[model samples]
Target: MQGPPITIRLLLLMLTSVALMTVDHRQNHLDTIRAGLSLVVYPLQYLVDLPSAIAHWASDNLSARTTLVEENQQLHARQLLLEVRLQKLYALEAENARLRELLNSASKVGEQVLIGELLAVDQDPFRRRVLINKGSDDGVFEGQPLLDAYGVLGQVVEVTPFTSSALLITDPSHAIPVQVNRNGLRAIALGTGEAERLEIPHIPNNADIQVGDLLITSGLGRRFPPGYPVATITEFEKDPSQPYARVVAEPAAHLERSREVLLVSRTAEEPSP
Candidate 1:
């Protein structure tokens, strides 16, 4: 055959040179030259890749509807599973709440009571107050005693048109007349702004109080019903030379955690005097 045309021969020589350069660069023998050439060709390489990128983007855009449908189905299935679990949880919670109410009702032998839900907790860190869903409209009055499944929570402090506020016994401003269940030693349990503890002040060092003793409302002030639990002695410090012992008690009621409460009405003979 006749010798290849001059232009074709030159193009073949250029291609051969490019291949040799590529091999040398891969072997790290022509790194500097290859890096310079790459920099020079970078814009051209990007321009060449633009067509393939556009094609990929168009393909994905065209298939978006199908992809979205598949993703939506997956999400709906997950939502259904979550909703079923939520239903079971709600049922369990309701059943537990109803059982607690039954227990409280059985314990209050002669008192009239109305069940109320805790609406909100006090925002002030200093005052221990809880808002209940009941108010004057529901026969809820100020000073009505609030109780949970275990013991006294507090008493109604303020009654609004549709809601009532309860001042917890753990409020610093509140104090309940209490007695040691074991020895029947009477003392006032004063709130110290602590959520779960109370202070029994002026208890004589010789008093028979001890750790683990149960403190119950003595009903001396007639504010709280008699025999209702208030706190349990958790710490007792008796100094032989001191006149008074230091006693710390933990509240027996779930005052800070309970979601429901019972508003017990005063007995007919026990009306406010």
Candidate 2:
């Protein structure tokens, strides 16, 4: 049970370690033994490191997936914004085309004209009227004629500081003096509360009017300028039993579709015959 004292045992162990280190350093005696020990412990070292390696791999994968998700969301939002902008561009292109057509009509009118955008349309089915953006401040006066690209649209009936109301040619209370462009036969075109139809009353049964005749403003009333297209006769019926012939014509202007119109000045002189 008894052994050497503690100081003597510690000195002996230190001497042994020094001797082994000297032999390993100078004679390379421990290289074979060190290789054998490393071979035996390599699997144990790998096992000990496996959990930390797996944790690092999992963390990298999760971070990559989160980054991809965020990038995808950003791209989707960008795509939606681009689509909205493209739609607006298309609308603007259509508006520009319409404005060009208005300019062409203005050139043919040979009158001082102001472009007016439609602000509102009357909701009443029987009343074909629309509100325009220009008014007295813009020289838009009552009885001022309105025209679209194709033909006469209407006349301004009410005016305010910044807006005006116009009665379309198809309104029931509206009437315009139109004559047959083919034969100079005079007739009155009266609105019948229909969007496309105008009734030409008081045409004699023996009148020279026929179907497919073009009707133009006769400049008789002085309300509208001369030689402006108004309507085309679609139906002409002669009834011997009736005193007047039944005539129906379609409006030339796209009253229900025009979004922009021209407010024509009243000073346009009549065309020379």
Candidate 3:
């Protein structure tokens, strides 16, 4: 009662398929019947493929959204980076302009001049001083003249190994000899502890000075070189009680805003015997 041998059964089925194919080829058998069967099974075939179609659609939509989101984030980051670089470029342009002016002004000294950057500013009320980066190590010494792009800034009063302190012309204790650029009238310019004011202690009533006169270093002290600008005569008034004329001058240097300064390497000298 066992089934026929496997090889024999396979051979029999193959022969039957061949016979059916020969008959169908000759007589067009099963043509109408096959059409009817396909019609009946078409709905089932479509039903089986629906899940795959929906899954493919969901996957494609999710992938596109994720890609768009990633691209948007990358674009935003790139824009921010470019903005930061542009700001830095603008700042550099302004700084370069300032440096060019400083170099041009230093040329007036006509002596060996060293450039120094500001380090710190004192907040003390009594002493108005600033520290520069160069010091004794850089050939800076006491009484070394400091100049900005506009005019004389200050003079180095103290020097350390790597830094030096400068006393601005606006300090109360500082004094410089100045002369009117128009007339040879010499006078002492004294700091008034004010940023914009310097007081000339005693100007004779008959002195040939007027508003708008440019003040230049007289070089009498031998501490500063000759022909450097100091301040401008802004006001002059006469008081009946006071013997000296009241005069106020504004500093030529941008004392509060100077970031870089030049130090004249000229040595301070004394009159020879």
lDDT of the candidates, in the order given: 0.88, 0.92, 0.90
Clashing pairs in 2: none
Clashing residue pairs for model 3: none
Kindly give the number of clashing pairs for every candidate: 0, 0, 0
lDDT of 1 by residue, 44-78 (tens): 99999999999999999879978999999999999
Which candidate has the top score in TM-score?
2
**Global local distance difference test of model 1:** 0.88
Residue 1 Cα positional deviation in candidate 1, in Å, after optimal superposition: 37
Better of 1 and 2 by lDDT: 2
Residues 1-273, candidate 2: write the lDDT tens digits. 999999999999999999999989999999999999999999999999999999999999999999999999999999999999999999999999999998988898877889999999999988989999999999988998899998888899999999999999999999999999998988899998888999999999999988899999998878888799999999999999999999999999988888999998866454322
Q: What are the RMSD figures for all models against the true structure?
A: 13.1, 4.6, 6.9
Which 10 successive residues of model 2 have the least lDDT summed?
Answer: 264-273
Task: List runs of model 3 lying over 4 Å from the truth.
Answer: 1-73, 267-273
Q: List the residue pairs that clash in candidate 1.
A: none
Minimal lDDT window, size 10, model 3: 264-273
Tens-place lDDT digits, model 3, residues 177-244: 99999987899999988888899878977678899999999988887777889999999998878788
Model 1 is weakest, by summed lDDT over 10 consecutive residues, at 101-110
lDDT of 3: 0.90
